[model samples]
Target: MDLHEISEKLQAGAAKAVAALVQQALDEGYPAQKILEEGLLDGMNVIGEKFKNNEIYVPEVLIAARAMNKGAEVLKPHLAAEGVKATGKVCIGTVQGDLHDIGKNLVKMMMEGKGLEVVDLGVDVAPSTYVQCAIEQNCSMICCSALLTTTMGVMADVVKAVEEAGIHDKVKIMIGGAPVTQHYCDQIGADFYAADATTAAEIAVDYCAKVANG
Candidate 1:
């Protein structure tokens, strides 16, 4: 199937159909990056907008994200095998004291769909874990999500840890969650705050591009 046909199937939330179209495109000699941008990313853009508008809820979003994920999986190995690097690398976590992961997982999926290499530190991640992962992974950005007001305070601690470890200037920091606000992100020294997954992916890819060009 063609990229346009694949993207339409994705918008309709047909996971297996989309995945097969991705494989078909790859088998027909389409570049992985082309399929990614015109197909998977385009589909996610629609899904993200629907989610923001409340026209689609979590279950539907999850299914679409899962389809996008399968497409990402099929393309990833080819991109690597062909020596094509990802746009950027990121370390993402739910922050220490936050056991919930739904929000973080969504952001991670969106980031991955945008062709980012994400090192997910999982839920209940410590400040040191984030800092260490950023250092070891050479991540261009570090993302933190906290679902509760109480756990959100840990964002400052994670930022502080990055500063103390002397890697603060080396990486951009991002924060999000239900209670996270732009004001809170600025107060906690985060470089970016995303109200949703699409904005988060946009911020990450844009930041990486700015630095790479500089």
Candidate 2:
């Protein structure tokens, strides 16, 4: 049976439909990994692209992500039983003193949609928290989000923390937010800077794939 319907329903933000279809696909003996990749991730990738291209907005991405989450819930146990590992692991959070979380949440959803295991540290996260979580979780990347200029400086502090922890070579750093730019990313020595959620997820996936292959 074609799993494209699962992708279509997910893109349409039909959460219950996506979940039910995922169960059906499993009952039909399709591999959980295939359903996740070809069905859920495929739909999310389209949504991400549309979001990046200005064809869709935040609300749409949120709903689609919700649908993806619903479908992923159905596949999670089966995936574990199949020994399907995540593409990569990354920790994400908003910087200290910043109560903003919408951007961080969006990046988390996009990363999850790409099959990356994300550890969300939530808003108002201290630099040391990022460093500790990366070490504890064995995360390959640390993604920092900050909407406030004052708080954005904490991202640089996170870089410093990682360097001071002596894990700079082990973990890549990605930074983004309204006030963050490639210039700021360069100035802070972050490994990647994304203009939007889609680009962030793309950068993360590419980085993780390279790390995996190497």
Candidate 3:
């Protein structure tokens, strides 16, 4: 009936309930954008905080994200009619030679949960692919994930590709994975480094907000 109820259901990971509640809210004349921001995103924000604090783990986060996605799907048509655009746009991928995708998938969900439009490039993505996608999509950030130390080097290549594409100033680069650290992020001239999916999404959202305001 109310938006808070929607948020509660999403946080509880009741996908079907969330979808029904979202539709119910829409039918009750609540604005689609308001439901998205106050209901779905609000729930996701709580999940992200819990994740950052280790109060919840990946499985819980994934479940809540699924619920949020279901709710979002129900509101898609209304969101389009209302012209409710995402807060930011980002390109996310596993860097070349890295086939790991669990982290990448988690980051994508968290980013979407934060109201950022994420373009997922799948696994083994090249530096050029990152740059090209960011440019073509008008994304403000590029997120690279690599689980292996050997693949982490490709993150630096992505930074270089962005620079060569002459979009370094227009986009921010963020890297993360088991083998990445703050030192590597700085050394490679990346804008940010996240130890996990929750942090990555939070940082990426902040960067996008700053770019939007500027």
lDDT of 3 by residue, 104-149 (tens): 9999999999999999999999999999999999999999999999
lDDT of 1 by residue, 1-214 (tens): 5698777787777888888999999999999878888998888878777777788887877888888877777888887777888788999999888899999888887787677889999999999999989999999999999999999999999989989999888888999999999999999888899999778988998998787787
Q: Indicate the TM-score of model 3.
A: 0.98
Q: After superposition, which runs of candidate 1 have C-alpha atoms over 4 Å from their true positions?
A: none
Q: With candidate 3 superimposed using the best TM-score fit, by how many Å does residue 59's alpha carbon deviate from the native?
A: 1.5
Best by lDDT: 2
| Local accuracy of candidate 2 as per-residue lDDT tens digits, 1-214 | 6899999999999999999999999999999999999999999999999999999999999999999999999999999999999999999999999999999999999999999999999999999999999999999999999999888999989999999999999899999999999999999999999999999999999999998998
Q: How many backbone clashes are present in model 1?
A: 0
Ranking by lDDT: 2, 3, 1
Worst 10 residues of 1 by lDDT: 1-10
Clashes of each: 0, 0, 0
Cα lDDT for residue 36, candidate 2: 95
**TM-score, candidate number 1:** 0.92
